[model samples]
Target: MRYFFLLVLLGGLGWCPAQAQAPAARHTFALGPTDFLLDGKPLQMISGELHYPRIPREAWRARLKMAKAMGLNTIGTYVFWNVHEPQPGQYDFTGNNDVAAFVRMAQQEGLWVILRPSPYVCAEWEFGGYPYWLQNVPGLKVRSQEPQYVAAYKRYIEAVGKQLAPLQVGHGGPVLMVQVENEYGSYGSDKQYLALNKKLFEDAGFDGVLYTCDPVADVAKGHLPGLLPAVNGTDKPAEIRRLVRANHDGQGPYYVAEWYPAWFDWWGAPHHTVPAARYTPGLDSVLRAGMSINMYMFHGGTTRAFLNGANYKGDTSHYEPQVSSYDYDAPLDEAGNPTAKFRAFRAVIAKYRPAGAAPLPPVPAAKPSAALPALQLTQYASLLGHLPAPVASPTPLTFEQLKQAYGFVLYRATVPGGRSEVLKINDLRDYAVVLVNGRRVGTLDRRLRQDSLRLALPAGPVQLDILVENLGRINFGAYLLQNNKGITRRVLLGGREVTGWRMYGLPFAQAPTVAAGSPTPAAASGPVLRAATFTLAQPIDTYLDMRQWGKGVVWLNGHNLGRYWAIGPQQTLYVPAEWLRKGTNDIKVLELLRPEQTALRFLDHPILSELSGPQP
Candidate 1:
């Protein structure tokens, strides 16, 4: 027990255990054509995937402990590429973005590791998990095994491999398996690409078991030679067994890599809730039948800022972007509190065990919270008033050249040549709309691979608005490395590549941003709390609905609850019972883009608003 503390102390200083702790066998662990074995002993996995960047750094230990208490022996985590390598070679491993710390913490809790290092992990993460700098490369085709795409991918893998390979179980670390590219079958039938990923894993010296997971329907396409096959979500173990058999002539004990504990919700979609009562029976059957399963997310953490991704089903841009909170309606919420589902699943685990083998912990009281008066942000800054000096070079600049971060970057240029009724972006990523004299001219979307639009320029001062959001990075794949945000190249006006753009960095979250400079806010119509007052005689549990308002941030007794947007799906903000105080507490909200008299409600349920169909 003392040794565990020592390991954590060393791990805190970035120590990857490399000693005679357990001499790893030279032979790599492989799935044989029999019941699955770990060190030749039959093993049953109870794995959970938790993204490192989702939860704050301070919360990692508590969240992991909660998973451990929930009977999880393996903790699955995805290493986000963008967070690891924000710039080309600049890597940041501090704070909540620390993947190594998270893994070590999980291991210290005696849990096996399934490190999903997909450059293209599509977890409703921004842009599906690719770095934003990737778009700058010329002639790049993501997902497919394109040469340019492969080059960037190889570089990123090499960089990240050094951090992870040494941490494998072979080196006295707990990483048991490393997933190759996630769910490739759903994207394309590129067998070569799958093979390439497999080769890359071996070449990177990842000695642990390598596997791939796809939906049940695409099991064949997802599986690779010399690796285990895992189905994403399988309520029926028989189907998993059938797939294993289909892959290896009926080998027993199939694996469910992503057994769904809950589901993800987008802005306009119905809030998906998987009742504890409904999920327990099927999971019980899996355990009783002696199979292994990994909960996709035992605890669904928040996406926080603009990192939330959008859902796209088709080729042309019909996108459904996700909300900030990735609570996933999970058994463990973003804050790591166990739900009724957690108890039900724990009950199932207890049923399969000898009496008194493991006892459940008492439910934790919600953190105490205090209410502050409504926050009034006095200064206002119109983004247009403060634009950086234009890039005068005829040659266009990438999002990198602007030295800007995320949010709508407007690039306006006056036409120097002919007055053709058409102007188009050579490459318009996500969304764009051209405006002349503050009037709508044309619209374009990158989801449709479109930046082309007709403009009606009538000889005089003309304005163009190419508002593109860094829709977060793509979290999975070769495409992940090529995630250069914004319009990488130039806007074409009358078929001419337009340069000299006036860039604006409107990160939205980073407020009091570049305005014409801070100006006094327009007067409010009603009571704008001059010296606000509030009283809470006793502590209470409540869900602060942050929806009905526009984009803004909130605070409780001076504790920042993070930013909130009126975007659909997340109309409420969770104010934990633990973060509250018993006496006169306070609540403060600073809203932007909303009318003066905004209303705030304390709703039921942990998430924003319980879905009652779409909002009117």
Candidate 2:
């Protein structure tokens, strides 16, 4: 009788019996009163979250296969809005941002998908996954019912729908559910805003089971009246049941949407790790209860480029910028290799596999890695020599006002100098290198709440240059709305506002050209553009050891590999093979702080736990 029903289901979805491995076809997935109903039968979704933008496009299949081997039946992913719509009215869904293709690949790997396409996904992403251009919109209030914000969000949702809506479950795709605004209750209790998001998704053609996920304390506030309320950060079967029953209709279908097996790391902090023994018991309980579950990060990939976000809990001293590697230390590491935790979790899940289910595949071997001999950066260029035309302003302009998103910004002005004075830059977003007459004088760091520096000026007019780097935008808390990079306010000298500034937006949209020359003197300070070239017999996965380097950003073959700091925690950047070539490969480094050595190394393994002094 079960075989007969399976045949009928396949026939209804237009799948032929011979095509056993065909892509997912049209099907019904609905929230039941006591359980999630898949074609009128209860279904437990053993899922894991992996963002498309985080993983390289070429390795999406391998990552999905890894998830399956870990005994996961589904793949959960967040469609980063900023990744798709980088600029207002401008959209990109190609290459690494190809979310639809990722979903299709998941289906091809025999896995269902849970699509979280929220405009505000607090996934440690820049500006909470909001496009940086949104800040330039006048009278716009994000995460609210403001008219302009709503219009812009609707347009973005429509754009995403055009790419992903057709891949929903009912449309013969793998997406079983689409999420509402992520963790909105913790941010705000605006039911109207949640309703607007729901309507927007519907208008965008998301016609599957829609759900809202939040912490246990926020399920009631974030959940819509008719949608499923999923809990995060907890795996206790009783708590999960109680939260779902209380927010829902006092029934069942309890879902732990975000089960954290480990945590993420931030700059200047130790790498976070959770023991498998800590959470496997909770997993067993949830599985034994027949409740559905989705691991927050089954495979936490890298937060490449300037996309990493920070945490500012309304206090300057509390600001913590996230590191480039988003390797959440889950079952799968950043390089897509299974860890000991993977085997432990798989053992727990194996016992819960449904009857007649296919055996889990053997874990795939780790990808090959290569270690290169130490090489010196042979070319160097001073940032002062490569200045573009500056925009004159009476005062320093914020990155938003300058129409810039990421990278460094230079503020220069001529100040009368005769005596030493205290230099203060109000609202310095992140880090700055203060230089007088093209010579490094001092530095100010926002992480340490150091905004004022005592500088000794020469006996004549001196060129004052303040090079500011936008570390990462605040991704969580009330400070998220106040995120403005570079120098947001006035520059004061000895308790007075200094005016007449020439602002240069160094977005570094492309790798700057470094003329062939010997390396800059190690004694030199401030920002320097360094370059090196090498040839590879074959491209293989590797980690660029930035331990000897100071605070800076690196680019390989014109692709930005993100930032690294001598501050430790994350000592290396994962260099994917997909971004490398077999011939000559060019590499560039924009070192913000002077390094003792001008050399680089490639390691076979990542150095994530090493610690060093915060200063260079």
Model 2 RMSD, rounded to 1 decimal: 5.6
Q: Evaluate model 2: give its lDDT.
A: 0.88
Estimate every model's Cα lDDT from 0 to 1.
0.66, 0.88
- Stretch of 10 with least lDDT, candidate 2: 16-25
lDDT of 2 by residue, 215-315 (tens): 98888888887888999998888888888888778876888889999999888889999899998999999999999899989999999889999988765
lDDT of 1 by residue, 1-616 (tens): 9999999989888775785355644323456565556667666777778887877676677787887778877888877776677667788778777777788888787777888886678887776766666665667766768898788788888777877887787677778789998888777778789889877777777767788888988878877766778888787877877887887556755778898988887655567777988889888998888777888888877776567766544444344556667888788876677788888898886666534455655455544443434433333433344455555445445455565545555566656423665666665555554555544455565544555776656676666555455544444433444455667766666666676665555544343332223434464321121112255556544566665665555566654455565545567666655456676555655443443534456654555444432331
- Model 1, CA-based lDDT: 0.66
List ranges where model 1 is wrong by over 4 Å: 1-34, 315-317, 354-357, 360-366, 369-372, 392-405, 413-468, 471-501, 507-519, 523-545, 552-564, 573-592, 595-607, 610-616
lDDT of 1 at 152: 77
